[model samples]
Target: MNRSAAEKEYEVNYYEIDYNEKLLITGLVNYFGDIATRHFENVGGSLTYSKEKGMAWVLYKWNIDINRYPKYGQKIKVRTNAYSFRKFYGYRTFEAFDEKDNIIARANSIWLLIDTNKRRILRIGEDMYKIFGLTKKDNKPLFIKKVKLPEKFSIEKSFNVRYSDIDTNRHVNNVKYIDWILETIPLDIILKYTIKHINITYEKEALYGEKIKIFTELKKQDEEGYISLHKIVDEKGKELSVIEAIWGIEEK
Candidate 1:
């Protein structure tokens, strides 16, 4: 591995692996997030910087495609680069590779800068673009389109946001949204299947002690696997996010 400034290495530890002994989707999300945070810190735009500026970076959407699952104790490298930005949105790409240089996963995400005090979107300035060290060579993010859910949900559950879910931004971290969605899934389904693609759109922010409600429904199925739609909301019916995932059953 080149170990360039844009790349960071992480080992798949016991805690990050699931019952199947493979790195889980939530674990991969957390790794990409940590790498992105490192990039911010390297460019003097860390969480502290956002706080001092009375603003914070919020994840708006994400799409991940997994080719192979890295098993426990495998060392993986995460490569991330910020390519473009608009008024309030920034686009970044992430890739995970195994020790043999096999690409295990790829992801695209969109983020927004919001005023923490007023909770409004901030018009990203030219200087802010430079702060991310953008190359301006990347294409527009492909997964920005809205994710539509099924008309009726088959499963709905509620959970209390715990202290651990809060990140440095003082809000329910975006990664937890994936965790909650996975939790709502049945264990039998998880053990029998694997997810190859996931698309999530974050519409609202959840805070500590907030109650989150998750709703899921089977969208469709094929020989390979199935796709499920999920909606995350607060107790008051405010929609927090929507996620659509494509899963395939393990080969016999």
Candidate 2:
């Protein structure tokens, strides 16, 4: 079977905006996921396993690059397409544009098929391959590099995972983890800065009962005062995820 492309549009909602009155970065990512998931489900694909003994899709990694932030009450069109499949992984690409067709952000993600019962990776089945029309691509997807946090990082805030933080998978959702890490930075810093790139590595799952320690370190790279390093660690001091965010002043 051959894989095909899917695209959808969305209007920025009030609830999706951040305190800065712009679409929340994390919320934007969630919207992309929601639309993409719906597109697959409409075609009889499963984002998570159902009762009939099937597997679900799990995000293995994502590379997101933002050019500009979307404002509240803006209508944005998000285009998504299934590009390829390899063994247990499916590669998808997403592009977001404003009403005028200006590109806001673009992302590429690798998803793994997982067996719900066995908690193991599953190969792409014939049915899904046919439905999604999975095919082979010539070039490899661009992957964000995972940088380790420096040893001199200092803890700025600590947070305990709440029940609300847990997703249907019973683990902290990826976006929420990014939110927690962002909360450690001051508002002034956020308002004046724009995130150019973010790369995160999911090491271990954070359960509801676990407390997360947030640490951050900033450094100047050329003219950009980048938030060079960020990390989340469990109660036992084991790292959960390491994120490196590069930021610069919004271009006039």
Candidate 3:
């Protein structure tokens, strides 16, 4: 069934904002992901289906573009839709809007439905696929998925996964991976440049209590923006997630 895109209204919570009183990038991502899950739950893609099928949805990668970051007390609406699937991959898109219906941010993500017990991608079944109104065609993204980072990097800092970082899935939430990456950048870089785009690939789950180091490198830059690469790794140096962030000063 072709369902209307799922939309939910929200107020930028005080706690979810940064020192600048604007919504944090991590917080925006959490809301975006929640909207996608909420869309699934509404259209017969219930938790019961997931459990009974022994399948769990895993995000493969995301490409997010930010136009304006809403500030505290701002009213916003998030819309999400699952569009297509092939093999083991599903495609979805989400958008965030301000009160005037102006777009604030948008993201395109790829996900995989996996057998939870087997820890491998599961060929999507008809019932589950039908619920998402899945098709073979792609929900093509607005921008090219071409963010690139250099091979070289520097060890920036380490963080311990605390209770706060774990989500309902008993793993470090995907948003925390973005947080970990942001934490490694210099304060000046973060303050001076607005994050216009971010590309992240989740490699492995970083469990609670694990200590992870953030390795970073400032990639090449030109008329578009500066690209920065980040790798979140465990104490033994095994990589957990890979991220590339594009930052630039807002145009006058």
- TM-score of every candidate relative to the true structure: 0.92, 0.88, 0.89
**Residue range 1-252, candidate 3, lDDT tens digits:** 456369999899999998878888888998988888888888877677787878888888898999989999999999887766666777788899999999889888888788877777887677765676654454343332644556777648889999999875667888888877887788877777778998988878788899999989975476555788887789998878788888987643
Model 1 lDDT, full chain set: 0.83
Candidate 1 collision pairs: none
Better of 1 and 2 by lDDT: 1
**Backbone collisions counted per model:** 0, 3, 0
- By TM-score: ranked, best first: 1, 3, 2
Which one wins on lDDT? 1
lDDT of 2 by residue, 3-112 (tens): 36666788888898877677878888898778777768767665443435556676767778888878888888888887777777677888999899999898887787
lDDT of model 1, residue 154: 88
lDDT of all predictions, in order shown?
Answer: 0.83, 0.77, 0.80
Show where candidate 2 strays beyond 4 Å.
Answer: 1-3, 47-51, 136-141
